[model samples]
Target: MKNRILSIDVLRGITICLMIVVNTPGSWSYVYAPLKHSEWHGCTPTDLVFPSFLFVVGLSMSISLKKLNRDNHRKIRNKLLKRGAVIFLIGLLLNWFPFYQTNIADLRIFGVLQRIALAFMLAGIVITLIQNTRSLILSLIALLLTHWSLLYFLGGTTPYDLESNISGTIDIWLLGSNHVYSGFGIPFDPEGLLGTLSSAAQVILGYLIGKNTLKHGKPGTKELNHLAVVSLSLIAVSLVWNFVYPINKPLWTGSYTLYTSGIITGFWAILIWVIDIGKKEKWTLPFKVFGQNPLASYVLSIIVVKLFIYVFKINGTTLYGWSFKHLFQRIFENHLASFMYALAFTFIIWLFAFWLYKKGKVIKI
Candidate 1:
């Protein structure tokens, strides 16, 4: 078997880096358009991050599941179930962590890790059930179409307004009132239940793409060309789909899936061309380290930042108060300064990831 692709690791690491950059902005209002999620009915560069992350999970599964085939089916299923449950629970715990400030009784039940866990479990079971590429492709198509049908035909009782879409209504009914994202001033979450089906499909699409890339023995110019062709085809299809469905992340619309998946495929194709085929080494070292220990870096980054802000009270204020973010805002008081603060914060997190890499300590799930 071919060893793990360094390019894939770098790609995953880059996605995680973008995730941190977007999520930990110094001031949300001043962020660049590419780093911001779309306000309503379209996909943005930032909208691609979550789907790209899930796609990487699928790419990883293509490798991991192949190894697990040596074991009995029951054992594999048990392991998948247990691992998925544990990851999902960890996500729930993170949501409620430092549980004093917020109401712990009804914390957000759905989050990044929870979505990952569910997508992994569902996609894993499907892969196990149907052991061929054609089946996987068919399943993905079925999921996307079914999800589209559900959302379109099962229009909300309140009408198909922008604010009261079918996805939000379903989430509100299923998740109850207390657990939805209030940031939108409505009972909806971009990572809601109905949208998860399409998210799982996104992962499956990644798995299919990964299987194709790996089927060729080595990364070659011909393979890169083929990848480019596939990427272009997906992008064309996604554009066509977007007209009818609208690329809305909140709804997790089918068009949104196609659009993000196209972008993700295009991104990996370029990375494979540059890093794998071109044999570029120098620029990728930091990303490779981050990729090697992504989950650990992500969780630790959040916890460490929160802890620092909580513990190091500076001048009757938190460490975050003394942060470049606040300092820049106080001095410049403009969007540009806010943008710089975000970049600095991102750099700091990267340094932390690099430090862990130097120690050769990677945390895995």
Candidate 2:
């Protein structure tokens, strides 16, 4: 609590809340446009949530890495591997949770936590190895540009088109058909292996921002002005890049990374100005609670949703069963019920987190 940055926690909390909102929409067919991810080669608000989470991961890494004064590189490496593996396994388990599905061979292997774990490990290793801001920046640029080049050149004639893309091809070959997403009628996952390279860069960028901000503590008007300048520059670059590459989440396009990173940076600047500089904490308490115990809140929400759908079996129907989800569908008799049900579920989870916070219980990895 003492070393925590209120603004960072608030950002993380807001992201988690939005993740639940976008993820648990009453019905996929009726979701608002912004809540749905882009079909293939464009972005929706939902597309930003995962990258924003990755950015925040980088921010948290900055803090953690800064505090590690020990020179035990081996120990740090082991810790990163262990933690990353654990987080990735949790995500995988959640994907195959209850572990009783007959289609076990076709279960998804990569997901949100898996992406986070991979990104965190890669970014941590990079930060550990580079040890210089300028070099880190160069590395990020190199990674992004290299990815773009590889996708463009190696992908050959039908670049950016979903069916023939190298990224998807590699994923299928490596992860196998059963382990990849068939939602698009092919074996592809948005969080697939190649896409994760850019994701790691996203986290690295966050680490850079956090490290700089902490170094320039008690950000004055001058620091705020500098942030504004950087944000604007990034937006301008992102806009240009979007024209060339397009903002795509499934592909994890370079433009999408820049665009989302710019937005998050701008968002961070505004929050810092308003809350940290303006000294406003009262309005941020709810978010702070979730932020402080995000993993607990997220894992608990998933468990609760599963339990409600499985153990409770309201009216002999699964929570997500056509009948149960439809009960509210009939009550509200529209998309609104689905949305409200999801919101209520989210709120219940928040209340649980708040209760835990009240008891001074914070779960960590």
**Per-model TM values vs. the true structure:** 0.92, 0.94
Taking every candidate in turn, the Cα RMSD to the unseen true structure, in Å, is 2.4, 2.0
Clashing pairs in 2: none
Q: Write the per-residue lDDT of candidate 2 for residues 62-149, one digit (tens) a residue.
A: 8777755447655776798789999999988888766674267888988889988998888878888777899999999987997788
* Residue 174 error, candidate 2, Å: 1.0
Overlapping backbone residue pairs in candidate 1 total 0
Candidate of highest TM-score: 2
lDDT of 1: 0.78
Per-residue lDDT for 1-365 in model 1, tens only?
Answer: 15689888998999888877777766666777787888888878889888888899888877766655534656776787788899898888777776664586578888888888887787777777776789889999998998888887877653234576777777778878688777787767777777778888888888888877787555677777777888788888878988777788777777888888888888888888888888887999878877987887677666756765666677877776577446787777566666677667767777888888888777766
Off by over 4 Å in 2: 68-70, 309-312, 321-327, 330-333
